[model samples]
Target: MDVLLTVVVPVYAVEGYLYQCLESIRAGLTAEENAQVEVIAVDDASPDSCGLMLDGYATRHGDLRVVHLTSNVGLGLARNAGLVEARGKYVWFVDSDDWLPSGSIRAVLDKLRETEPDVLLIDHLRVHENGRLQTDASSPMLRGTVTLDRLLAVQHTAWNRIMRRDFLTKHDLRFPAGWYEDVPFSNPVLLAAERVEVLDRVCYHYRVGRFGAITATRSERHFEAFEQWDRLYAWLDATGVDQALRIRLFTLMISHLLVVAGNDSRVHPRRRRQFFRRIAGLYRRHRPEGYQPPVGTPGIKHRLVAINSYAMYSALRTGYRVAGLRRRSTERTPVVSQDLPSAPQRVQTTSLR
Candidate 1:
């Protein structure tokens, strides 16, 4: 039987999580079901023993294939390497630091058989360090509709979506190297896809707040977010996506940039002002004519950004941060706080490990 899905996991220093991640791929599936799935774990020259561990695991499990790179490439290029080795009809990129839920493989296979969509969007929950599970804020929005605007509105993580191999290859949709690489790759796949389906069930568990994890750590590389978005902007101009769609994308871009700039975890306090100014520069260059900002606090932010008011924005951020701290102290549940405009979750293009 031919492989129906190829699961590509880019592994770096995820020694603690790699075992569970690989095991989850075959957890609830029978031998026959497992036969129809190909697992490729790319060891991106991990500094730990992950490469050696992968070799041993592949030897013990005949179906698992391991790719050992000579040097550490970031997450985007590592996934691209795994894509080249995939032979299945469809491909799913699973992060090594995360794992699939039980029976997810069977669920995905069944969905693919039923819909045969060029792109399949799946729901996921954010798994906190304290064992709390919070549904992705965008989960409710994932439905039968496959419009480009709706697709763009959903979270931009690659792991939450499964794509047909031929569709990706035909469009030459490979991830670019740098942070926020998903910005360029995920949007274009959705835009070019002819058929799309959504599996509303939670198929994956996204690990959050893990020590040394990409989304959790502070890094100057967050600046790459602007360049990555620029890549998509270039694509939009080249493809001549409709003016309305361009506006929608532009709105999303501002929201995403604000999220990054205001995020204390991603951008350091010292560099926050610089990041905000850079975002304001982007706003001036790309803000659509006659564009109306969204309502509420986010709208206020858009208006502030329009005038390049970093001082005002910083004051507003201070207020939000104070309010968020109060809420956190009162609430016991481990909730991921969102104090900025509604946008896709901030994803790191580098290895989560």
Candidate 2:
């Protein structure tokens, strides 16, 4: 029997969340659907019990297959390994710490059967640390058959969609093995896609873990983000894709980098200026014609701030220092207010020992 979907999970030292994520994947699939679904868990040389847990899962479930690596590789490499090992017709990438909502797999499969699109985009729930929930509803984007350019402009995350295996293989699209890998791969995938379907259903629950997660913590590895952005922009310039699409990709890259710089404290002042200069150069070189910036507060400022390297670096350094001082002052002061909301319920989902 041919498999319909393969769920590829790249596990690192997320031993505490592995079982729950697997269970959520199982629960998301119906009995029949589960039978057709192959769960490929790639252990990226985790120091914790994640590798052992994956071994146990493979032993118990007939559909589960665990691939253990000897050394720790980044997320993109693990995902690429899973892609190579996948035998299903369609592939869905799921983070080891995150899981799909109930019946999400079946819903996505149904949509896939109906549309038979090269790529299917679904909604996702952003689970914040403050117990706030945000949904990436696809209705607005689902008005018509979306072109590659439009899809590139809208969705950036690879986890929220199910992509046909042949399409991926044909174009040789693999995630770049780096810290910010998705940006480069996603642009190419979108450019290669002929027809993409946007399903409004929310299928993914993205857990926000502040301290331990990759996006939250400050690290020097973030400097590589600029390199990936440069590669993506270069790829767009070389490809035969529409000029409008190329411009959109460039703007999106610059805007995203600015936001990352704004939020990060570890990025050095000189490096921030360098990133800004690179983006400014791209903006001038491309000079996207009749390009209207997206509406909203951050949208306009993000573009404007990205245009000037010195201004951005200065503002970023000042903001970082101010935030650091504020945090220190708050720590020194006693708790004076009781009106603040309580922290969200934190669930420890697994046990390594």
Candidate 3:
């Protein structure tokens, strides 16, 4: 059967919630729609039973194919492997721990088939561990015209988008191999896409807060976030993108650095000083002239980075912790202790191996 939409799921050590994620897809599609859907589950050598579970599911569902990797290549490579095997008009990515709301598959397929966009953007519901549910913060700006600015302005999530398989292949878009891989991949897709559309509906049910989740834990690998952005910058710059858009990316770069630093509490204090040394130089190199951080604590932190002042940033962070004001955002209640915004979760990938 000619596939209409291919759902690529990268599986890792998510046995705790894998079933719900897959069941949602099963429950979402109708008999007719299911016929045109192809599900590819990439098992990243998960030590857990996730791979075995996927194999069993494939036996039951004729359209679902299970690809088990011999070793763990991280989420980026796993998704890339699936993309290589995908034979569908459109491609959709769903985290192994996250699920589709009932009927989401059908709704997304309808839009993809009708509009036939190079990429389709959809809103998601973020479900926090504390039972807090918030609509994606970018709903207002993600819709309407498909300008480079607006598209770049929205969340850069691989799962929240459905792109034409040809569009991705034609552009050679693939996720980078490690932390913060989504942005480098998503940004290019957004930039290359000729026609993009936003579906106002909330089709994705995203789950946050796991004991070992990426947002919850931070270590040396976090530095890869910058390297990821640098690769993206090179890609965009090669295309001769407008300077204005490059400035926007620079602003985003600063914001992401702060957010990554804020989310990380596991680093040793001395190591952080070393970390800041390397990142501060990057901040100086990447920040556009006359750029200011967005208002609030994150902005203040960004200024510290801009000035290359690790000492000052440390002092303010200590003051906030001592004053018991570190968790507060300038806007609303933060889903996580991280000073980041209400954006989509960047670490929502397979937890295998």
Candidate 4:
């Protein structure tokens, strides 16, 4: 029988949590749901024992398949590999460190069967280090069909959603292998989607570990985020996505850059200033002729900082330099807590896919 859904999991150095993630998959899908489920776990040459564990799981589970990568390609490439190999009508990408709630697949499939939407957004819980679960207020975005403009105005994480494989393939939608890759890929998908459904039920549990992820490292790779944003803006202008939608998209992009720049204490003052200036210039250059700032109760500090542009950048630089100096003088390590429960091991099974 044809598969109903293909869940693509990109594994990389997540050996500690891989078993738990796979077990969540097995336990989450009911027998009927399991019959329609096909899991494609792509191991991106994880330096840890994750590849071995994945291989073991494939050997035991009939529904699980493992793809071993020779080199460490980024998450975008790993996800793309899974996408190309997927045979399900619907595709869902889950990070190896994250897991879906029980019956999540069946819930998504039920929505897909009823709405037949190009994309389905589902709510997710952000699991913190204290083992506390926070209901993301942004969860409502998964409730029903929404326009591209509306979706862009809120959160924009690519995970926690189910998408039709045909829709993605037809539009050539693939994640860009760079920092903040979602910005470029997801915007276009949103614009191209004919229909989108938002499921109110929480399906994904996002584990926010205390240990920083790739995004925490500030390096040349982080600069790639700017390139991704530029490409997205160019695409919007060239394709002429609804003018209103374009405005919202532009505002959101600028807002995101401002927040990042303001929060980054590692950026040099000169570089930070340059970054803000560039963003402000882009805003002034591309904003449509009658563009007016939205009036709200109060603008966020980052948004306010973005308004000054250069000044904000300079301030960030100064703060970063002081923080760096302080760190050098103190020779002290900050205390951090790691209190989340350990992921459970999985029962190995043979491949059924």
Query: Which candidate has the highest TM-score of all?
Result: 1
Task: Kindly report which residue pairs in candidate 2 clash with one another.
Answer: none
Per-residue C-alpha lDDT of model 3 across residues 1-353, encoded as one tens digit per residue: 67898899999999988888887786845678888888889999999899889888878876579899999999899999999999889999899988877667877777777678898888788877765677666655655444567667677789988989988878888888997889799888877878877777677877876766675665777778778888987897689877777777777777666656655564556677776776778777666655667788877877777778988998998888766764553448545543313223332111101
lDDT of each: 0.85, 0.73, 0.77, 0.72
Q: lDDT tens digits, residues 218-243, model 1?
A: 99999999899889988987887888
Candidate 2 residue runs with Cα over 4 Å from true position? 136-150, 265-275, 281-309, 312-353
Candidate 3 segments exceeding 4 Å error? 143-147, 265-270, 289-298, 321-353
RMSD of 1: 6.4
Q: What TM-score would candidate 4 get against the native?
A: 0.81
Model 2: lowest-lDDT 10 consecutive positions: 344-353
TM-score of 1: 0.91
Q: Kindly report which residue stretches of model 1 are placed more than 4 angstroms away from their true locations once superposed.
A: 144-146, 327-353
Give the winner by lDDT: 1
Q: Which ranking of candidates, highest TM-score first?
A: 1, 3, 4, 2
TM-score (C-alpha) between model 3 and the true structure? 0.86
- Give a tens-digit lDDT track for model 4, residues 24-110: 876845677777889999999988898889888888876688999999988888999999999999999998888877766767787
Specify the poorest-scoring 10-residue window by lDDT in model 4: 344-353
